[model samples]
Target: MTSITATSAAATASTAGKVASPYNNLNETDFLKLLTTQLANQDPTNPVDNTQMLAQLAQFSTLSAQNQTNTNLTTISDQISKLTGVPIKVG
Candidate 1:
């Protein structure tokens, strides 16, 4: 797993008017960080819409569940391979 550092996060959140991305390859963590920064910096008078927040939460939930499912499937496949004494090919 990649570590998130304050320096890196700040740097990424300040890239020439663009949202600084502290990742060579953007993933869920980076995405969540960016979302968090946006929420924190949003104008109080013109806050993010409730629907938008709910949508983001739903998307994150789906992503988390998908990642968990993938991990579980991988573990199961590994166990099956070990039990069968054969290598399993995962895509």
Candidate 2:
């Protein structure tokens, strides 16, 4: 029925929103929440397999790592910039 489909779609949308990752900010918690929600809402008849899950995990891990690296690089850049801007004093 259309109502049933609408309800299912609505539920999926709500869950997705709850587990949605922040743009330009994807952390471990966001990834875990997303995976949990995906598993919970997956179709019963055709559920996700181990391989797929592993792939998704790998992808998320890579993304998280890259995000961390970018943050570290930004911090280092800022510190370097500050050091360069400061005038040196000589006796």
Candidate 3:
């Protein structure tokens, strides 16, 4: 039983480390699946409020959009810096 539990845990961790998307790893489909699972498993007596859920979803959408925007800005900045012979430091 102990060995089985260890193997299961290791398998779970290994699967989680696998990249599902080559670009934008945390995409909409993954986000929606997680949200659905949370909703399905929530406590019935004190369930998550509709307003809070919508707000959370909106926040996720905003974060994803911001990440895309940041990526685009970084790419453009890098291109401009290259043209201007300026070194851009990214951390």
**Model 3 quality (TM-score):** 0.56
Please rank every candidate by TM-score, starting with the best. 1, 3, 2
List model 1 lDDT by residue over 1-91, tens digit each: 9999999998976785675545646677777898899999999999999898889879878977998988998999999999999988766
Error of 3 at 35 (Å): 1.0
TM-score per candidate, chains pooled: 0.59, 0.54, 0.56
The residue pairs in collision within model 2 are none
Best by TM-score: 1
Error of 1 at 32 (Å): 5.1
- Ten contiguous residues minimizing lDDT sum, candidate 1: 16-25
Per-residue C-alpha lDDT of model 3 across residues 1-91, encoded as one tens digit per residue: 3456888998888997685755557678888898899989999999989998899889998998998988988898899899999977644
* Superposed Cα RMSD, model 2: 10.3
* Stretches of model 1 off by over 4 angstroms after superposition: 1-33
List model 2 lDDT by residue over 1-91, tens digit each: 3356888988998898678565647678887998899999999999989898999899888877987888887777777777898543322
Superposed model 3: Cα runs more than 4 Å off:
1-29, 43-46, 88-91
